[model samples]
Target: MLFAFSIAPAGTPGDSVSAAVADAVRVVRESGLPNETTSMFTTIEAETWDEGMDVIKRAVEAVQAHAPRVSLVLKADIRPGHTGQLRSKVERVEAALDEG
Candidate 1:
């Protein structure tokens, strides 16, 4: 199935954002879904901010590890310079999933 997964969060503190992202990864890892893409995304925004970007990267990496066959789609509001940074990561993950 073509799944639309999103991880954008509302305005939140940097730490809380990472925490939320970790939690989401945990949930996905534990959900035991055959296709991770079939599982809905949760609290992805927590992984989007400057402070939270690393956490977001780690979380997505974890997800990729746990569900190597799943596709991931990430959406973010970005200005000119940052237009495709996170989006690039998301696409990379999706490509990896496709390859796997």
Candidate 2:
């Protein structure tokens, strides 16, 4: 499963939300799952829905600690028998571009 999500604190004073975002990313990093953090979202690969959601729940909680409310955007591609799609999916696209 490939779970991509963006979590952040809402209604903060300053324009910067980096501190709260960093906390969420920290939780994902410590999970030992296949993961990547980009400007807009963090993507993680997990074997089951429970495993993936647990990480996201904790990430939301991390951001929630900094503010009264949190905003989360999530997208998932769940394939039961597939693993390592996190990097493999991108590699396949790049390979296709190279071939073209």
Candidate 3:
């Protein structure tokens, strides 16, 4: 399964949540999972549903410390027996774009 999630601290400094975001991303990366982070979300590929959700759980905790409120947006693509789609999915789309 592949999960993409964005977690941020609300009521933080101005409109910039980078500092808190960094803290959360750090946890996700340190999990040693295949993950990609964009401006809005962090995508993680894990072998099992539990493993994936656990990573996101840690990330949210990491952000909660920085602000009084936390906001999270999560999306998931659950396809059993699939792996590496995290990168390959985008690669396939880009390949199609190139063909066009």
- Tell me the TM-score of each prediction against the true structure: 0.30, 0.98, 0.94
User: Could you give the C-alpha RMSD of every candidate to the true structure, in order shown?
Assistant: 14.9, 0.5, 1.0
Candidate 3 colliding pairs: none
How much lDDT does each candidate structure score? 0.44, 0.96, 0.94
| Positional deviation of residue 56's Cα in model 2 after best superposition, in angstroms | 0.2
What residue pairs clash in candidate 2, if any at all? none
Q: Give the better candidate number (1 or 2) by TM-score.
A: 2
What are the per-residue Cα lDDT tens digits for candidate 3 across 15-40? 88888999999999999999999888
**Model 3: C-alpha RMSD to truth?**
1.0
lDDT of 2 by residue, 33-99 (tens): 9999999999999999999999999999999999998999999998999998999999999999999
Q: Which stretch of 10 consecutive residues in model 1 shows the poorest summed lDDT?
A: 31-40
Residue 50 error for model 3, in Å?
A: 0.6
Ranking according to lDDT, highest score first = 2, 3, 1
Model 1 C-alpha lDDT per residue in residues 1-100, reported as the tens digit of each score: 1122444344443533444445556655454322133234543222225534444455566544433233345644543344334356569899999999
Which candidate's lDDT is highest? 2
Residue 89, model 1: Cα distance from true site in angstroms: 26
Badly placed stretches (over 4 Å) of model 2 are none
- Quote model 1's TM-score: 0.30
